[model samples]
Target: MTTSAIKPLTVLFFFLAVSLRGTNGEPCGTSSIQVQTINTGETAAGGDSVFEVQVKNLCPCSVRNVRVDGGGFATTVGVDETMFRPVDGGVYLVNSGEPIPSMGAVSFRYAWDHFFQMTPRSLEVDGQC
Candidate 1:
């Protein structure tokens, strides 16, 4: 075949490969989520350091039932239970088990002596990517 014809064929193959990958019938995993904590340079009522926590969902699909290892999470300041609360076994639930839309995030604040080692424990894919 001519050089021009081969170039078009290569491009077609590339697009086909990418489309196939998206339809693999698999959902995003906990790895697609990220937990970030930042010191706000402020103190709470008890003189503990205040930290802002943001949990971001990086997956293209929506997710729900997101749980994290609270690790005995505590703070002098109050955090909304509907946003983030410990249920049991040191696991904290996010968004009251509601779906966190694709690329969406949940944020809250806490006051403690040090930053908590928050890590994602589990999540369920709510929709297709």
Candidate 2:
């Protein structure tokens, strides 16, 4: 083949190869999680109180061995266990052996009687593979 024809064919082949690859130019071995609150409810302490957490996988591979912690209510008196098992699938109870699929989401709910009176506490939900 002539030089001009060969060069064009080489470029076209290279482009096709790159494009056919999954997520071309996307960084591999990278993942992310997004957490959000979905709902709230009234507490017995005459205040609005409830906890919801959403965990999302933003990676190409599945995440395994996920654990959540720090979902405790902090009050002037002291910290207490106000979190409970998810009444629904949106709220995920702790599962040490389950694997979170790639690009998946899980959520759960928690309630507190004196959430407002408590010292604005935060929950730390973590996941691992």
Candidate 3:
């Protein structure tokens, strides 16, 4: 294609990409999900154990589907979103319910038959801001 023709197409693509991020050029929290695993002594070997999963959003924008894939079956003790489930092989995915603001953190606990092994996390937000 001609250079001039390509320029307009490139511009259009750029705009579309920005719009999906957020409004008013706020940008999107595309890759800003932090996961913190805390060990709590609530059980013995192969016994019931408790753990805390802390998820934080370190982006200037927002993110969704803040999933934490931890090994073993678990129960959500506390969290803003109710869209949490076990995917496979003891991995769990949780929806943040809403966008997580920059530096905002969401914490939840789980009780399982084994220790905690979390991988790949996401984020959510706080009160309206």
Best by TM-score: 1
Pairing residues by index, what is the TM-score of model 3?
0.50
| Candidate closer to the true structure by TM-score (higher is better), 1 or 3 | 1
Candidate order by decreasing lDDT: 1, 3, 2
* Cα-based TM-score, every candidate: 0.79, 0.41, 0.50
- lDDT for each residue of candidate 2 in 1-129, tens digit (9 for 90 to 100): 899899999999877655433254432222244455544564525354665555565655565444343345232222222322332223323333255566777655455543321111122223432
Q: What would the per-residue lDDT of candidate 1 be over residues 1-129, giving only the tens digit for each residue?
A: 999999999999877765533344456667778999999999988899999999898877888999999877988889988889988889999988899998899989999999998999998889655
What is the per-residue lDDT of model 3 for residues 1-129, given as tens digits with 9 covering 90 to 100?
999999999999988776555554444433456777777876534565777677777665555556666655455344334545665566566652555557777776666665466666434433332
Give candidates' CA RMSD values in order: 3.9, 10.4, 8.0
lDDT of each: 0.86, 0.43, 0.60
Give me the runs in candidate 3 sitting further than 4 Å from their true place. Answer: 1-31, 42-47, 72-83, 87-91, 121-129
Quote the positional error of residue 46 for candidate 3 in Å.
Answer: 10
In model 2, the runs with Cα more than 4 Å from the true position are 1-31, 41-48, 68-93, 113-129
Considering only N, C-alpha and C atoms within 3 Å, which residue pairs clash in candidate 2?
75-118, 90-107, 91-107, 91-108, 92-107
User: Candidate 3 — which pairs collide?
Assistant: 100-124, 100-125
Of models 2 and 3, which has the larger lDDT? 3
